[model samples]
Target: MCAHITDSVLYRHLWGTDETHALLDDGPRVQRWLDILAALAAAQAEVGLMPDDAARAIADHADVALLDLDDVAAETRACGHSTLGLIRCLRRVLPEPAREWVYYGATVQDLTDTWTALVLRDVGALVARELADIEQAARTLAQQHRDTVMPGRTHGQPGLPITFGFKAAVWAAELGRHRARLTEGRRRWEVAQLGGALGTMEFWGDAALPLLDAFARRVGLAAPDVPWLTARDGVAEFVNLLALITATLGKIGQEVYALQRPEIGELAEPVTTGQVGSITMPHKRNPELSEHLVTLARLVRSDASVAVEAMVVEHERDGRAWKTEWAIVPEVCLYSHTALRLAHTLLDGLRADPDRMRANVDAHGGYLVSEPVMRALAARIGKHAAHEVIYEASLAGRERGVDLRTALLADSRVTAHLKADDIDRCLDPEAALGAARSFVDRVAGEA
Candidate 1:
């Protein structure tokens, strides 16, 4: 029985995507480990530490389907060692010539960490592709809504006018930075770990360096300068990057969640037939996918925190910290994949309501464009006096629950400097959105 939500049959979709779960599942992970074993055997043969014939057989018969996982689990319980049981089960299935060389000269960390390198290599590529898709979706939103004006809220109050395109461009610009980070951090985190016990390859003698290079080439990873037995920073860094990516997705989700509110009604996530938002409330149209992105982000961040805590490992081969990564690393990768996938979906079908945006902006009764009026009044009267006149009129209008036009018209001070037409021009929210269109164009062009 699976106790974790990521493995639970009912709640797994809420925690991870199908693609992500497949990558992090026990069977696939074990196959990747077998791949590392095969590479290790081949690398040892390249350096003359093991016979080439044995290495070839190990590589040929490294399929996980041949070994009974139930027996492997039983051996793991009886032997009280992590990789030994795996090696014992693996050895039993290999041809007589290759059985002894199946895991030649490699420790548990060597196989697991090398598998981590492959995980990063594959997962990093997947993340970059999906995130680029997210950027493209945001770019489309920015381009489509370049002139769609909306209220810019500050502290939960409408402060000024801004186009919806500008908001989307900000998201695209941030996604671009994440792409840069992933590209730059790839080589640093994709190096293979080949250190034997005590961070030295004592078993392979002088063939150690050559074996390391061969193993890395065989596994399609970079050769590490030194073993990372106690140095868990690479794992920490990978998970941290995942955490940051998920955080950005969380921000996007939060924005959609808030905007999909009945009171706001400016944006909504895509809905499908037979997908109920609530069991009892039939009228509720909830942001299920967007909300789940936020949930997945929180879970990834928690896993990243554990990765950081794992960095404090003591001495060489500290099982306490390194072992934590056996779960934490896979969790971060899985949760991050789910978050990115959901973000792509949420952005793809995002519904932007320009009519509601205009209505929301106008609901403030011209007060939202107060800055434009203040600037216009400033050109005539001294800046301080203009501020005082408009400030007093705005307060009176709010108190009387009337538009700024009526309040300004009733004030002799305002009337002396500005006509009704001039005030109307200044009160237009569309006129107040300065440089918003240009900003969208700039970000979209760069993307």
Candidate 2:
């Protein structure tokens, strides 16, 4: 009966986690709204804007289990307002005296935006934890494969030699940067939004600032300099950070997908017992998780664009922009959560083939060591001139189906400056890996 794939009974596991789904579900969302109202009431009472007894009563009955959500929905539709139905339903459950002061002067934005801050705090924490785990796994790979030589590629072709550890070190370094971003961004995106209808808090008079601080304290968030009723930069920034994170994950996935090809056969995603890659093809091991990571990144990036668009709303209050976040925020969180989880699983059990990697490098007929050859020749015959000589020899070698050493030996320009022993040294893949092992050590040591 679900409409979206994210909510599908059979496939929801692919899109989100149970913990995040529970956090954003209707029951928990409403409970959070009620909790925000209770915090507001308590803060209002603390500021002497409302009676202590009424605040206590509202707090006691703030449970979502006590309300008839059907009635709440009908009232919402009847009133054509986002929070009125919920307010009315809440009033019905409250004692007579507390009913009048249940919501007070707060608007829907106050409740929803604060709820968003809380959600971001939770999601950001989850992301940070998952990123740490992923970083550690990548670091482990880097250490394990510090000397596992592979062909470094550029423009989809073998360019030079590199260690698999170097590649994993890159992933770890990027993930570490994301972790730092999360830590720094928490202060900006995890603050409360309690501006009333006009964002001026005029309804509460002199007690506004005090109430804001108290409410934020109750919810364990920082109070902002002002209400963000129309300023959505914080939300946009957080979503965009998620976009950056997923994009990195997608990059890693793409690498795995490419290397898992039978022709390359240097890396692979871990396959579980009895896992079927295809129903039609009996001999196939598709890079399913890697492909899904790319798909999730695309979706998260799309959501980030919507978040950016939401930043340009009209003055004071804009339902068009604000309501978009109602959908976009949860979706970005869910998709990002799923991505982090999958990435962790992927890296934890990732399979690397050292022999296959060495074989692939050898398969290139010493072409992968061209960079080292060019560099060594550069020191002798001026860099540009050596480039032309190597370029011509490389083309001839490929046409003649011979190794780089044979090609170089036949080229008078190359043999004139370098002997066979020098050419052999240049063609060594280990010599071609300039500073790769050192970089791996640096990244893994820091990790």
Local distance difference test, candidate 1: 0.88
Clashing pairs in 2: none
lDDT, model 2, position 253:
93
lDDT of each: 0.88, 0.93
Q: What lDDT score goes with residue 429 in model 2?
A: 92
lDDT by residue for model 1 (334-447), tens = 788888988998999999999999999888888888888888989988789889988999999889989888888988998898898999999888789999999999999994
Q: Please, what are the lDDT tens digits per residue for candidate 2 over residues 98-123?
A: 99999999999999999999999999
**lDDT top scorer:** 2
Off by over 4 Å in 2: none
Q: Which ten residues in a row have the lowest lDDT in candidate 1?
A: 14-23
The TM-scores, one per candidate, come to 0.96, 0.98
